[model samples]
Target: MKANKASVEFAKKVSKGTPYKFTIDTLIVDHPLKKVTLSMGESFSYIPFRVEQVPRYNNWYHELLGRRFRNYTVFIESLGKEIHELIPNIYRGESVPLDLFRLSKPLKIKQPIVRNLSKASSYRGGLSNRNIALWHSHGWYYENTQDRWKWQRPRLFTTVEDIWSMGFVVPYITPMLENAGAYCFLPRERDTQKHEIIIDSEGSTKGSVYLEKGDGFKDEEGSGYAMKVPFLVEGENPFQMGKSRRMPVSKETFSTISFIPDIPEEGEYAVYISYKSHEDHVTDAHYTVHHSGGKTSFLVNQTMGGGTWIYLGTFRFNKGYDQAKAMIELANQSDETGQWVSADAVKLGGGMGNVIRG
Candidate 1:
């Protein structure tokens, strides 16, 4: 059987300079015939029927085969927000931690009386994906003024009735893809590129290093320099070649350094920077990381505040290139404006319904 041309082309593109070989497993059909008595030159006929324990085959493509390719694209797009939003933190090597808190006061009812009751119920309700709240009552009693009985009988009351009872209230949680890391490096003395300097540590590393721009090491322009430090290896130390000791960053002081290494493996990395903004907010911003052939690339993005959202999408690459190329490819792929096209084709045939016997 002949292979499809588009599939072949896609294989060629992704295989360019890649060291690893890819093999696609496909499903096969087998026909077993029952024994039949026949004479020489005698012909017989039988109705064709498919026989198998289960309907579908087990395979990655098979499972995903029937699904709308566009829907998959949409899913990846929707999921990209989560992945990209968390990439910065992932690149920084941080994990999502769950924090639970108890409500001290009943939430102020906003809607109409009816809506308020419903809102209150929602807050004092059970666990949910977004947030959860529970309610408990303090034992107390009050006279029912509307009751007409001569003396108000001892009224039975639960804590919920006396005091507003509620439980666990959670914050809006955005999913984070962890272990994402990224890095950008340059030789000791080189022209610094715009948007190329910032890196996302993703809550992974404590600090980053970048080359200082211009020859103002002696002036205010060089007094306290700032650059985006992409995520780097956890234990790998970032230092300048000629500098002997490491300098720590202080409130008003900035230290100049040599190179920042790229992540150790193939994965998503976020962009983050360490700089004192005009508002004096020292933020560790984050953005996603893309790699190709092991070379690092930089995706320029707006600055993010502390605890901002970033999504890191799925990673794919050619292995033949060195770490630097892979890193670059990662950055390029992460560009919010960059386009990513899948290589697989949509299948439509099922059984022998349209088959013809010769």
Candidate 2:
């Protein structure tokens, strides 16, 4: 059994809604049966107001789901169980639905109070924290007794609230992730069409970073070449539908996005775009590569790794910000149905080898 590993880059300001980064140098698969080659082992963070819709809904198998899931809520006459319970006493008095908390039984000792559970260590076993007995991200997780794995440890400890509070910035919730398109994390990128990419601004640059969303999106499963379960490496990608990104369906030759980062740097950087291939949705991502001498465009079939980056190509540029402005598009051929157009992070750096470089 190979454990998936990552090198985390903690943010200097680890506050709520702040973005953190993780670079995954090794592509270790949970099971040998599954081949997970890392094109670029990297991840970032965000306080999820709403997650991408997990397309793997087994609606066909069980028509009677609401009865069993009565713990949830019901809306519009449709019976639905409350799978997640919001953590009380987090923020001020009012609350944000996006800051949903899935706890493992309320904490016995929260802020100000502390108790020595040294003898109680037998109950927690290997689960150790600041002795607060809490996981760092995603507030608290949801689990049941049926979980045969490491589903133990209902902590009685307490820790600082800042550690768990990821700046929860709510974005415009869409039905699908790709319908919103690729991005790095920008606190305010929650505009109707969320689009941007990694790293804090190093210096002043030229062009603005651009991101948008369009048509053509459908729900899918991760069994094939799609996002497999547990895509979340630390605080990123959880294989949840709300966690992925894609390009919208279009009647035009290409639905596009453009931007120039305020932060600037100069160097030769390779572009890595993440994508997933599923049985449904046919999409090909396109981008315009600009350099000192000339510029050209490249394309790749969006369906591939369950949510892994595929190298598109590289370019050379002078030391400046404007020169770093990037524009990537997902071609929406009039004849093509554009069922699946993946729009993920357009990372600029030295990633793994390019899967499809033109």
Candidate 3:
């Protein structure tokens, strides 16, 4: 089969105020083709499935080295998320964790959610020429420090040599093409280039990291999960990065996470917040998302989601000393201890997404 070209369909609408509901449509392409639905695929540690939950610990213990590395067998057994079926190469599959829906800001669709998954551009019968399928898989392992997983990435994956590594598979995951199959990387660059401003919540060597459980509120152990978790450097972190974790963000004279505006002064921009519960401890965390437009408050059970970028709301703000900075405040009174209450990172649309009048 000589293959080339694919398409993806996704949609999002304004929610309440600045927040929006974003969802990708599920397409059915029964026959096998050369298609692949890649997501955060650029990420070495990016797992295809969503992280459901983690075991909890009291008093926040510190691990200098990192999580212990379990043997391949042991690690696979403890894998919490299930391996979902691939969208098949007859040519269509996109995103991770199958059905994915979250609070997202309005933005134009940049790349095809679906793409050709076959390693060979042309295949006939059981024989073909060229293996172009991408050989990829990732998950958490014993990094012995903060980084839980070692990561398996195909460097020359797009070049050659990677044809050997393309066949590696896990328990539940099925190969989109046959093992020893050749697949090529299809480039989907139709979307316009995006400009984004990311504020790392953890203490950044670049500046004062947005670290806060609450003011003057330090736990007994004095160990801080915020300081330990890796910074949001190109979406890389040992522990899950973003928002404040295990700290009570006091509403009074305090915000969970904050960052100053660096460009274009201020205007109408879509707002986004990234944070997730790490372990079994699930608390209904309350938040008042503040931006240039105004304040929108809501409640969320952080435990429900692993690490994710959530749409809080959108707004218009002016550029000033403290005016342009974005902030997420923890408002849940019941969440007194801030145990597992996390606030990691925040994002401004930088003039992306859709702007509905409703």
Q: Number of the top candidate by TM-score?
A: 3
Clashes of each: 62, 44, 48
lDDT of 3 by residue, 121-218 (tens): 43343312232323233422345565453444444545443333323431112234333222222121111214344455444423223434445432
Off by over 4 Å in 3: 1-194, 203-244, 248-263, 278-282, 323-325, 335-339, 350-358
Give candidate 2's error at residue 121 in angstroms.
Answer: 64
Q: Considering summed lDDT, which 10 consecutive residues are worst modelled in model 3?
A: 53-62
Provide the lDDT at 355 for model 2: 23
Residue-level lDDT of model 1, residues 196-284, one tens digit each, is: 22222221112222333222132111112221233333442232101111122233223332233333333333322222122221121
Give residue 317's lDDT in candidate 1 (0 to 100): 37
| lDDT of each candidate versus the true structure | 0.23, 0.35, 0.36
Order by lDDT, highest first: 3, 2, 1
Please name the candidate that would achieve the greatest lDDT relative to the true structure.
3
Task: Please report how far candidate 2 places residue 50 from its true position, in Å.
Answer: 66
RMSD of each: 31.5, 29.0, 26.7
Question: Local error of candidate 2 at 131, Å?
Answer: 46
In order of appearance, the predictions have TM-scores of 0.18, 0.32, 0.33
lDDT of 3: 0.36
